[model samples]
Structure formats: structure tokens, C-alpha cells
Target: MGISPELRSLNLSNNHLEGPLTVSSIPLQLQSLDLSVNELNGPLLLDIPIPEQNFSLEKLLLADNKIEGPITASLGTMTSLYILDLSNNQLRGNIPDSLGNLTLLTVLRLESNHLNGEIPACLTNLSELVMLNLASNELEGQIPKELGNLAGLASLHLEKNNLQGLLPLSLAQLSNLQVIDVGENNLTGNIPSWIGTCSSLLVLMMRSNNFKGKLPPQIGELTELLILDLSSNLLYGEIPNTYLNLAAMVVVNEDMSVVGEDRHAPSARRVRPCGAPSGARSRHPPNIRGITPDSDHNYYGTCVDYVYGNEDRRYYIEGLDLITKGSERHYAYVLSGMACIDLSNNRLWGHLPAKIGNLKGLMFLNLSRNSFNGDIPGSMGNLSQLESLDLSLNKFSGKIPFQLGSLDYLGYLNMSYNNLSGVIPQQGSHMITFDKSAFWGNPNLRGCPVESWKCSPPHSPLSPPTIDVKEEAKEGFSWYELSMGWSVAAGFFAVVLVLTFKVNWRKTTFDQMDRAITFLLGERTN
Candidate 1:
């Protein structure tokens, strides 16, 4: 009796098959074989000792098993193997280079194993290899330059490894490449200037690498490039202007141009495209002219520039320009290392800028009564020397920046009568004191006031009444003597009023109107 010569498919999956695979019992014409996700154990010993020339397997899967030991050189004997999955196994040792000789193999997977050592560079010779993923392993060394020859390659992921060195410019050779992730590695040097020139390159991520130097000025050319992450690298200098000026990111101060920090003065530090965390001073020349702490820039120098064209004036006011250049009365005492800028009780509006903390030399700052809003910038807390800050009677709000505690010298803080919230920064640092009055009228405020004011917190008047010291003094003038004379003259008018009312109590409306109109019109006519 002659047996039929037809064989098609076989599935031996999840059967807990153990020990050596009996390849000799597999059907000769088998097109598919599956033995995956099983309890199979022991070394992947080829049961048949067939020679390479006589191999006939087309598809084979022995994944997710306890199969161990090295892939023998005999794996090269399966010349006709097209689809092979030996993933999720305990396989160890070097991959046989002879397997690269298989010309007809299209799909191959050997991931999730104890694979070690350098990836075979000879494998890049596989002209038909596609969709390569060798992630999550102990693989090392540099990626082969010949990988640029994979003409049909589209997506490649070689992330999370110990790969190093500069990417070969030949990578620009893969015309069909789109999604590439060589991230989380030790890749270094400047990004290829021509990378933005690729027409199909969409998602390029080289984050968490040693990429150094400026981002190419032409990166804006990548209009289609989305999700570009160049973080965790050494790239520095001003953020590229071209990379900015795009609508892709919703960020503040995103314009990476050699842009001035405040957009007005080169005097401000050169903030780069990538943001520096707060209080991060740029080493870019220190903007020597930029006002900073521990420097004599804010004081101790002859006035090179004054707030008003003439700070020469000893006393000043917004209502009048009083230039008391050399007046003896102009002198006022200011303690050394103590700060007092009285840009207060003015018609000023707008929020207090956090930059105020730059006054590391400040022992006092009284913005006491301006119309500033917004929470204090946390940067203020960096002022270790800030002993006194009075932000009273303004419209400032939100929790006082917690960083306030860092003000080791901050002995007095007053946020009274404004809208503020949360606990006052209670590090009790330099915290000399405050009373309910110090933080009065700020319905959102809670917690104990600074120590000193508990006895009698200042009352919350409906509003902070502005007292003009000069005006108050003027009111005390003996000018009251002049008013007394007017008072006596006023007594004379008091008698006149009684006589007129009693004598002409019944005067008519037309008579009075006619009399006034006649007198005024007569004078006009004359």
C-alpha cells in the first residue's frame, strides 16, 4: 500500500512537551509547526542529524520555553527556514554566524533570551531582513554601518542597550527608513546636519544619550518631524531660533533664539532653547552687567544710571519733579547690607516680579502698597539674605511661595490685606513675627502669624489709608490762626442770613430768577 505524499500543518503548542525536539518525526512536507508558550524543557537538541543540503523545514516556533544552551552550528543546516521564532527561552551564548548564510529566510526572531556578546555585524548582509527589534537585552558594542544598506527597512528599534559611538553618516543611505529609535544609549557627537533633510523620517528619538554640540540650525526644515526628544545630552548654547517659531509646542519662552532673557536687554542672561531649572545661572559670560547677588552692581557704585534721569534728586515724588541735588535735607540714613526701595504707595499696577530675589544683599524690601498681583515667584526664597519683605496693601494672591523659608535672614514678612492663601511659609526661618493684622483681610490665609505681632495686630481698616507725611505736617501749620480770622468773618454772615430770611420770607420765584438773569445778562450786554 502506497501512502499519500501530502503534508500541510502541525500544532504542538502548550502541550508541555519536554526534552529534545524530535525533528525526525515531523512531517517531511510540514509548512507550519508551533510548540510555543509551553512547559518544554532541556536543551533545544535537533533530533534529526540531517545534513544542511537535505533540510526541509519552512516555519518553526519553539518560543516561551525553558529551552537552554547554545544554538548549535547545525542551525545553519536549515537552509529553507523562512519564519522562525525562538523567543522567550533560556538560550545563551553566541549566535552562529553560519545562520547568516540562509538566503531565503525573511522573518527571524530570537529575542527575550540570555543572548550576550556583540551582535554579529555579518547579519547586516541579510538583504531581505525587515522589522528588526533586539531590545531589552545585554547587547553591547556599536551598530554596524552596513545597516544603511537595508533598502526595504522601515522601522527599527535598538533602544535600551549599551550601544555607543557616532552614528555612521551612511545611515542616511536607508531611503525607506521612517521610525528609528537609537535612544537610551551612549550615542554621542553632533546630530547629523543632514538628518532634517530626510523626506520620510518622521519620529527620530535620540534622547538619554551623549549627543553634544548645538542642534542643527536647520532642524526647522523637519516640518513633519514630531516628538523630537534630545534631552539628557550635552547640547548647549541658545536654543535654535528655527526650532522655535513653530506652533508645535505650547510652552512659555520657547523661542530658542539668541533671544534676550527679558526680550529687551542683552543685559539679561542668554536663556537657551532647553530650559534651565529655576535659579539656574547661565555661564554665558554672566551678563556681567546683569544685576546679581554677591555683587556690587545693585549698590556701592556711583550712579551710572538712575531710575529717574536724575536720581541726583535727594527727595522725589510722582506728582512733582523735585530735584534736590545737593540739598542738605536730601540725606537719609540707610544701613549697610539693608535694602530699602520705596517704589511703594504709588499708582503702580501689575504683579511683583520674582526677579526681586536677585537682591541677595537685601535686608529689606518694601513694596508695601502697590497694586501687584500673582503669587510671589519661588525664586525669592533663594535670597538667603532677605530679612524683611513688605508686600502689604497690594492685590498679590495665591500661597506665598514656600521657598520663603530659605531666607535665613527673613525676619519680617507682611502680606497683609491682600488675597493670599495656604499656610504662611512656616519654616520659622528668620521668622521674627507677624500678627493677624500682618496678614489681615486676606480671607484665604491660615496658620500662626509671625511671632512679633500677636500682642496687637494692626487693624484692617477698610483699606490701607495713605498718609502723606508732608501733607499731614502742612495741616498742623499755624495756618489755623488764619482760619480763625475767617471764622469771625463767617459769624458776620450768620447774622445776615437771619435778617434776610425773616424780612423776605415770602419772596416769589419769578422775582429771584428775573433779578439774577437781568444782572448777568446786563453785564454781558455792557
Candidate 2:
């Protein structure tokens, strides 16, 4: 195939292109190449013919392909590279330690591959690194303590690996970190208290691990935290009411500007398309380099160039997996505006804080499979934005609060397998939509809308007083009956008095009575 030596960018993604990619075919001047979502197979050959010093490639995306074999150390020679994505491929073997040489690198993604071995401590050498994703690999061993050196790191994803040992203490140095997912690993030990020091944290997931101990109250200091998932662990102790300090969860209008402000913006910054003439002015302001500053570009930093022509490829970077509505759901760009707390499948016990209602912006809450007891906070009705709530398999007992009937946005609710009793709330449009399953296992609970369980009707001021059958039978007459008899006798006396005083009326009545009596006598004689 013939190609222009001046070519600076080539995007042929989502095609049926197959066979091994010939690194030598890439142009020396190429600054961006995106061949993602294709059938490209065979070992990735980074032995490009161009001299490393002259190579201008700044972005390389080969995700979602059939590429295999260990990453070539030669890749580190691409000094100008800032974005490197090889995710969702069949690549195997250890991540090349030489990759640390890419001092200008901002994003490095090698997830969803068979890469093994301990993470190279030298990776911390990339002082400008913004995002590092190495999840879903065969990696083992403790995370490197040197990682704290990457002070600019904003997102770190190491979930679904064979990692072990306690979280590194150095991580507290990451003041700008927004997301940290170390879930589904063999990590143990209590969650570090210094976590609160990272005040900018937005998502913190450490579920499905062996972590045990009381939750640190310091976590409540994360006023900006949006997602907090510590589920499926051995953690015990009641949740701290200090969680009410999560300011981001309390206000419906979240400050999304914090998502990628350090490196990019959630909103796409307009810029010239790759290969656009350098002298040409774009309709929007240019970003660092010619690249459009997008959350996907600078946060996940996937090597896709989206600022081309009429196409605005704003991609949501998958950041979390949360169990919602009885299934695991992937959260991506919307994570910025999402507020959720999942502490289910633990040994936590106690009444939820009534102040929890202060988190009016919370959207998902799961406290199932715990030892929590006592009445569900009626203050929960204040969560006007709540969409899903799970409080199943607990010791909570009491009447479901009628205030819950006021939640207009509640869509999924599960309060089953509890010690609850009394009528299920049946007022809100959303609340009435729930079936009996929502209140199952609570044998004491009764009401319509949950099932045909017999429940006493609510009292009304206009309703007549109830009568006791046994008492009425013993007395032979009720107050209601006595009142009726008195009314009849009073009417008779009043009529008698009126007839006696009014002689004309008295004569009229006597004449009518005499005529009726005479008619009756005649009929009988005949």
C-alpha cells in the first residue's frame, strides 16, 4: 500500500482489517494512529523503521483487537507519545519496564489482557502520568509503594487482579486522585485512614476483599465523594453518621467541573482535527498540543481523536461496576453526577442515622445482608433523587414510614426478609408500583398494594364511632338506639302540643280519624 510521507493522522477503526500490523508501514511523521475495534491479529510489532528520535507519534490506540505477545520494549523509545492504549486485546507477558522511559506519558492502559508479574516500580518515573489502568490482568504481588511518586495521577484502576497485601500508605500523597478501584483482589488489612486526606476523591471502591475493621470516620471528610462502595468485605461496625458531611451527595447539582479539571474538562474542548493545517484557526480554542481536551482524552486518555470534522466522539470512560437493581451495572461518564453508597454483604449493624436523609441527592443506596436493625429512617423520604434502595435481609422491625410514600423518583425498592410489621406505604405513584416481593419475608407486614394482607383502615374524623357487639348485646341497647328512641318520643310530644294549642289543626285531625274509623266499620259489616 502507498501512503503519504506527510500523513500525520490515520483513523480506520471499527473495520474488518485483519493480519499483522506492519509497524514499518506507519509514517515517520504520523502523530496519531487509531485502528481500534478491528480484527487485527498477530503479535504487535513496534519495531518501526523510523528512528526513535525522529518519531512524532503522540497517540497509539489498538484496543479491542486480536493482538498478542508481550509488549515490545521498543515502544518506550517513542518519546513523544503521551497516550498509549492496548486494552481489550490478547496481549500477554509482563508490562515492559522500559515503558517507564515515556516520561511525557499522560495515559497508559493495558487492561483486559493476560499481563502478569508485579507492576514495575519504574512506572512511577512518569511524573506527568494522569491515568493508569492495568485492571483485568493476571498481575500478582503487592502494589508498588513508589506509585505515590506519580503525584499527578488522577485515576488508578487495578481491580480484578491477583494483587495481595495492604494498600500502600504512600497513596495518601495523591491529593488530586479522583478515582481508585482496587476491588476484586486479595488485598487485606483495614482501609487506611489517610484516605480522607485525598479530599478530591470522587469514587472509592474496595469491595470483594478481605478488609476488616471499623470504617474510618475520616472517610466522612470526603465532602466531594460521589460513589462509596465497600461491600462484600468483612468490615463490621456501624456506618458513621459523619457521612452526612458528604456535601456532594446532599446537593442535587453536582460540580461536574472537578471531573477532569486537572488534565482536561468534562466538556469537549474544540481543536483542529489531527492533520489539520497548523496555520488554520478552528472555531474553538486549541488545547495543549492540537488534541481536543476531553474527559475521555485526558482522563481515560483513550487514543481516539474526536475533534475531527462534524464528528464529536465524546466517549464515556467506564470507571465503575456497581450492583444496582439486582444486577451489576457499569458506570462511566455519568459517574460525575451519580451519588451512591453500597455497604451491603457485611457485618455492619445498627440503626441508620436519621441525618442520612440530608443526602438528598443520593441516587442509589444498598444496605442489604447486614445486621442492621431498627426502623428505616423516615428521613429517607428526603432523598428526592433516590432511584434504588435495598435494605433486605436485616433485623429492621417497625411500621414502614408513611413518609416514604412521598418519594416521587423511587423506582426500585427491596425491604424483604426483615422483621418489619404494619401497613406498607401505598401513597406515592412510584411506591405503589412495587409488588409484594418488595416486602416479602416480613410476615407481620400487611396492607394493600403489597398483597391482600388484612390491614386496619386508617381512621377518619367523619367516620362513625365503632360499636362493640358484646357490649351492645349485654346492654340491649346502644347509645345510637337510645338516641333514636328519644328522637321519636320527642317528635310525638311536639305534635301533641301543637294540636292542643291549634284548635283548627286539632279539628282537622279528629275529622280525618273519624272518617277512617267509619270506613273500616262499614267494610267489616259487609
Q: Which candidate is the best by lDDT?
A: 2
Candidate 1 lDDT tens digits, 191-270 = 88877666444346576688777667665565433334454466654335454322222112212222123312222111
Worst 10 residues of 1 by lDDT: 314-323
What is the per-residue lDDT of model 2 for residues 324-419, given as tens digits with 9 covering 90 to 100? Answer: 877898754433346789999999998888999998888889999999999988998898878899999999999888888888778889999999
TM-score of each: 0.44, 0.76
Q: How far out, in Å, is residue 394 in model 2?
A: 1.0
Runs of candidate 2 exceeding 4 Å displacement: 48-53, 254-318, 452-526
Identify the leading candidate in terms of TM-score: 2
Taken over the whole model, the C-alpha lDDT of each candidate is 0.55, 0.78
Where model 1 places Cα greater than 4 Å from the true spot, the runs are 1-7, 11-22, 47-56, 217-227, 237-526
**Model 2: C-alpha RMSD to truth?**
14.2
Model 1 C-alpha lDDT versus the unseen true structure:
0.55
lDDT of 2 at 393: 94
Q: All predictions: root-mean-square deviation over Cα?
A: 28.6, 14.2
